[model samples]
Target: MQVSGTFLAFAVLSLLTIGGAVFMISFTRVVHMVISLGVTFLSIAGLFVLLEAEFVAISQILVYSGAISILMLFGIMLTKHDAKDEGVSKANKGWLSILVVAVFFVIAFWGIQSTPWVAPPDNAAAVQEDNATQLGVEIFTRFVIPFELTSVLLLVALVGAIILAKKEEDNE
Candidate 1:
């Protein structure tokens, strides 16, 4: 069997995505974690692009890597997260986390392996050609209210965060 460039690209992106997630979880600083999350988001967007979904990839980058990350950074900056030294040792917490992750991984692997995989339908290629256009049409026609409501909810959250931060500043 011959190795393909696409496979190599996918492997690199997958590693980056997993590495980012691991770093995000391992980092102690909130800002560092958020940056790692952005890396992970970008890697996911790369995966989307590799799958030929350029529009989805761009949206992923814009929404997750850009907006959501900035939102998280703003939230972190606005809040006071004073470190409180607790009873749990870092090593113990690390071991517990590892064990929990291992169990979850095992369960996920089992579930995926046990499931019956189905082949794509004959028209799958035809549908793939205009997925982005179809998605936009569906969202605007059928899901416009929900889409707009989501934007409203995000605005509300941003305002709430600002208000809470202001209240804290006043208290201080």
Candidate 2:
């Protein structure tokens, strides 16, 4: 009974996550898109919880929902178009989009359902016994360079956005 309930919860969250992602990408309003992205991040955190990855779940909520979403919202505000405006209509190929998305979803669902998953042997499972500690050690030791590089990349992106959004002064 409990297992079924958990399974149902996971399924619902998964759908919510996908829906949120679609809303984020499809909506023209930047604020609405950011809110939808928040929903997606929160749903992903819930999924991590359902998978028993408590540390990862907490980090997902903290980093993505807390930091990344706020950063995106700030970026939108900095762009000088914070107020909602019915801007020029772009090309809307609704039927083509629908067909493409439907085909992609069908193929993805079929692949996921058809795949066979096997659990590791009992002895090998010991590798996960202290997952949080092991994960921390690996991140700091083995993956430290990549982690630092990602931080640098984020910083560069922030600077680029700021430069792009700045207004040029007219020289008399």
Per TM-score, the best of the predicted structures is: 1
- Please write out the lDDT profile of model 1 over residues 1-172, one tens digit for every residue: 9989999999999999999998886777778888899999999999998988889999999999999999887777667564322334787897898799899999999999999999888987677777688889989999999999999998998899778656454454
Q: Please give the range of 10 consecutive residues that has the lowest summed lDDT in model 2.
A: 82-91
lDDT of 1: 0.87
- The CA lDDT at 73 in model 2 is 83
lDDT of 2 by residue, 67-145 (tens): 9999888878877566454543444666667788899999999999999978868887567666689889999999999
Error of 1 at 77 (Å): 3.8
Q: Cα miss at 122, model 1 (Å)?
A: 3.2
Q: What's the CA RMSD of model 2 in angstroms?
A: 3.7
Query: Given candidate 2, what's the lDDT at residue 122?
Result: 83
- In candidate 2, which residue ranges exceed 4 Å CA deviation? 1-5, 18-30, 80-92, 123-125, 170-172
User: Model 1 misses residue 149 by how many Å?
Assistant: 3.0
TM-scores for all predictions: 0.77, 0.71
Predicted structure 1, TM vs. truth: 0.77
